[model samples]
Target: MKRNIVIASVAAAALLTGGTAVAVAGTQSSSTGAPTTHAADAAGTTAGESFSDAAHASGTTARASFSDAAHAALKAVPGTLDSLDLDHGARTTWDAEILGKDGKWHEVTLDASNAKVLNQHIDRDTDAEDAAEAKALRNADVSATEAARKAASSGTVTSVEFDGDRTPVWEVETVKNHKERDLNVNAQSGKVTQAPSDDDGDDD
Candidate 1:
């Protein structure tokens, strides 16, 4: 198990180095552990706005856009932003994080086009999941946001992940005109170069 940095106060919460949520603030508020929340897209927004600004706009989409979205999703979270990543996966989304909301950290993904939330997950710094995720983050040549933008040439990116085989690679999956394809991007080189995923779906 990977150890988290020592957390003494909320002020020190947002200093995540590797997906660590050193502290979460509330004892009374209950959160749905890793919930998949889907709501209608925010209406009447022009394109090319910064994700942080768009999330501050309004409604359900407001519940899941950028920093404010992460803020409202939970009762008490960190004040500082750890990492903000943008991607075209699942409709041009922003995957961002804030640290030490009590003993857990928050990650909220939002659609850039309409400012819709795709998913949200909270993790304690001590969770085993954080270890793997942190490793994946280390292996990436580009953010999921960039991979998704590149993926558009293939099709609409449905999802992305850092695949750890002998090396780190971004597994970008896409669907275009009702067809799907999986691509492997070199984490170090940021190239869309790798053989297709094996039949068993393993990178080996």
Candidate 2:
């Protein structure tokens, strides 16, 4: 079990790190977690446009393009625009199924700086059996937000998505009464979706 930082403040709830929220058994909360635009892409903008502006500016290109997007997002974050960095190697930006606080899957994406926010989408097509498995995981302390992809081998996460949308997450699973529990994680910089689990089969 690895231990990572968790930020729960609504003010700084951006997903800066890569995909999925990773955690160990007993973790603590902390500060600092982990942005956004377009003309800024063509001519660059000030630090007043919401973070989303920077994300959509570059669309889907290369890591360098994302770097440019990160710079743009930093410039538009509101204040004097401090420093910003983009890890083109983040997994959350590419994964498809991101967990959320509601113990459900959601679409997620985080900027290179992980300081801004974007909207969330859900996977309506996940097979009911798989959905049930995911729900079971959620019930076993698994975070609905992005969960750190435990490296199976030495493969890089190409692209990620939840059902179909993009989003961020912190924690996913927990342990209660000696049993793994399911839930959502928002330790540090990340996003968490809240979708009800009442949809039976009309999700498709």
Candidate 3:
């Protein structure tokens, strides 16, 4: 009877020890899984931070570059003296002092969003009556020499002058019938401004 009791006690002790070992193994496995989950979460957070930082930096750089370019371009434009604000957009009409290739001061209208050349008024063309009037005026000058007549038949002359300001009917030089000639024309009322003169300098 004493031996049997000792055997039974030993078996119970072995079973308890085996259960404790299994529990410990299970706890270790659970702890390992938690660390892996935490590691994955940290990696995801780091990746997101990196992407956000890159996007923010890119946006900042783009804005700075665009601002710099815009400032430089605006400075380069000449005669941008004043600006006007409109309902839809601002109308930036540059100073009308900038002379174009046609020997006339031209005003440029630019879009507020983008600087675009909307319209341009360079030089005015001479009309038939203005041409005749100019010829008569030049005829009055005795000392003046006359060149072949080149009519401004294509268009009418808004103004004619030696300098920037438009004066009375003045001289005109044009190509008519494939021939270049220096003629005189009138500005307003199409009166005789000047006659054809060869001795004076070129009309245009």
Candidate 4:
């Protein structure tokens, strides 16, 4: 009878030990899986933050638009805009020429990124041709802005300059589908025409 009891006790202890081992193994697996899930979530969050930071940097480095630079030039000069050009060299800049009410031409330079005026000067070396061009411009019915809007029907206008060659016109340069186009808009009748190409086969 004693031997039977001993054998039964030994069997119960073995069963209990096996059950404890299984419970311990289950706890270890659950703990390990939890850390892996947390690591994956953290990695995802870091990647999202990196993308957002890159986007912000790109936005900060982009140049200002054409309209913004024109507005800034007008605000600084407070005159009739004659020509505006985007110049790229060591630094990108917007060069603006304005005819003031005092019959003098003002040249203004602005930073392309923030539209801040960098330099300005009055042109005192005016001649008969300058006076004639200014007079024709003032007498014209259409303005530079109107000419640009009319030219924009063809493509995106990049620059506008007063061309006083045979007839008073606003020369507008545009780009569309990666092709550059030069258009001349009449300052009086608001007529648009193709500009003559400057390349006279000098390379040939």
The lDDT for every candidate, in the order shown, is 0.39, 0.26, 0.22, 0.51
List runs of model 3 lying over 4 Å from the truth.
Answer: 1-151, 154-167, 192-204
Quote the positional error of residue 192 for candidate 4 in Å. Answer: 1.5
Clashes (backbone N, CA, C under 3 Å), per candidate, total 10, 61, 13, 0
Residue 80 of model 3, lDDT score: 15
Best-to-worst order by lDDT is 4, 1, 2, 3
Which has the better lDDT: candidate 1, or candidate 4?
A: 4
Q: Measured by C-alpha RMSD in angstroms, how accurate is candidate 3?
A: 44.5
RMSD of each: 14.8, 17.6, 44.5, 34.6
lDDT of 2 by residue, 6-95 (tens): 311121212222222222111111122110011121111122322343233323232322223333332333111111112233332322
Clashing pairs for model 4 are none
Stretch of 10 with least lDDT, candidate 2: 33-42
How many Å off is the CA of 90 in candidate 1?
A: 16
lDDT of 4: 0.51
For residue 153, give model 3's deviation from the true position in Å: 3.6
TM-score of candidate 4 versus the correct structure, residues matched by position: 0.64
Question: Model 1: per-residue lDDT, tens digit, 62-87?
Answer: 22222223223332333222343334
What tens-digit string does per-residue lDDT give for candidate 3 at 1-204? 000000011001101100001100000012222100000000001111222232232221111111121122223332211111111223322111122222222333333223334454432443454334333332222110011011223111111122112343334332222223333533333343345465677766
User: Which candidate's TM-score is highest?
Assistant: 4
Q: For candidate 1, which ten residues in a row score worst on lDDT?
A: 7-16
